[model samples]
Target: MKISTETRMGRNRRNPREERSSFLILCEGPTEKGYFTGMRSRRGPQLDVDIPKGDHISAVREAVSRVSAEYDAVWCVLDTELDKMLTASMLRAAQGSSVELGLSTPSFEFWLILHHAKYTKPFQSADDAKKMLKKISPFWSEGNTRFSDFADKVDSAYARAQQISPDGKNPMLNPSTSVWRLVASIQGRPEAIGRSTGAGRS
Candidate 1:
């Protein structure tokens, strides 16, 4: 995909000759691909969201290898429960590479649940998170969930995620996710952390 060199609206507004940061988002599943593909930024970095064929590790490795000078950041969106061994291997491989991880523990549904309310309880598996998520969003279907349903609540979710995990580390921890950190980066609002609504319930 070609990178957009045109300046965006807010902080990214600069002379036409100025360069914009390009981003590559590699997702683990169709749901992640669909969600991130809808993300738009008027002033933030340009993004290319993709879901490559193969396991998460191999996909991530492929994505990392594709990160050339044309892209400034390459983010891999993964679910911790999909493949623990592969996830670990991918993390190890990302050590020296430019690839960054946006991981969700148990499943990516945990991140989506945060959009509605705070849920700190540890989920047994991705299915567990999905079951709980259906309670809040009856329309949610794995790999079919739409981004438009919760796009407006992204900030709320991000704040709740920070409240639950301030440092944004350790995806092995139940109910922990660093997806918000990536969203904040895409939005160019690193300082937008810690603003919570306190509406989340256990």
Candidate 2:
């Protein structure tokens, strides 16, 4: 059998601009890690996950320390949970660094909830967000939900999240999330950043 050059190279040929970028995602929760892990497996991005101890601020500090370690980018998946003071501190910590944040108000579950429905109601606590998410996705459980659970709805969730807030500038904003930015990066659609519009089908 004869083999063509296209078959040999397959779909591995990426332009200079399309070259795969490496990422270091820092988060504390298992659920966030699980979802990003699933994305890494499927999306083919050069990514690494780091679970740091302590609060979201610590995660930002960790990202700051690691951002210069040769990775193309570094991000923190954090739940601000209506704590403006803490959120402000975190933002301050990341200001001079290349550390990006996938911030969700009340909890990361709210970001997941966007996958199923459009909601903008503020939750007082992480538990409140989790309870609401359970009502929407009855099967959702912390640390166990994988990307495949709602893989097909990524574009929808991205659109819904974009509708809620335009960017990561306001982590203190209630019921808001910038997780869509991280999702866009993982999808190799970094141009989607700050785009408050259309849904890009992944």
Q: For residues 32-71, write the lDDT of model 1, one tens digit per residue.
A: 8778877756655677988888886787778778879877
The residue-by-residue lDDT of candidate 2 on 1-202, one tens digit each, is: 9989898787766664356667898986898898888887533777788799988788888888887756777888888878878778877888766677778887889889999999987787989999998999888888797999989999889999888786556677788888888888778676755543211110
TM-score of each: 0.81, 0.83
Using lDDT, give the best candidate's number.
2
Over 4 Å off, model 2:
1-19, 193-202
True lDDT of residue 59, candidate 2: 83
Q: All predictions: root-mean-square deviation over Cα? A: 8.5, 6.0
**lDDT (Cα atoms) of all candidates against the true structure:** 0.76, 0.79
Residue pairs clashing in model 1 are 118-200
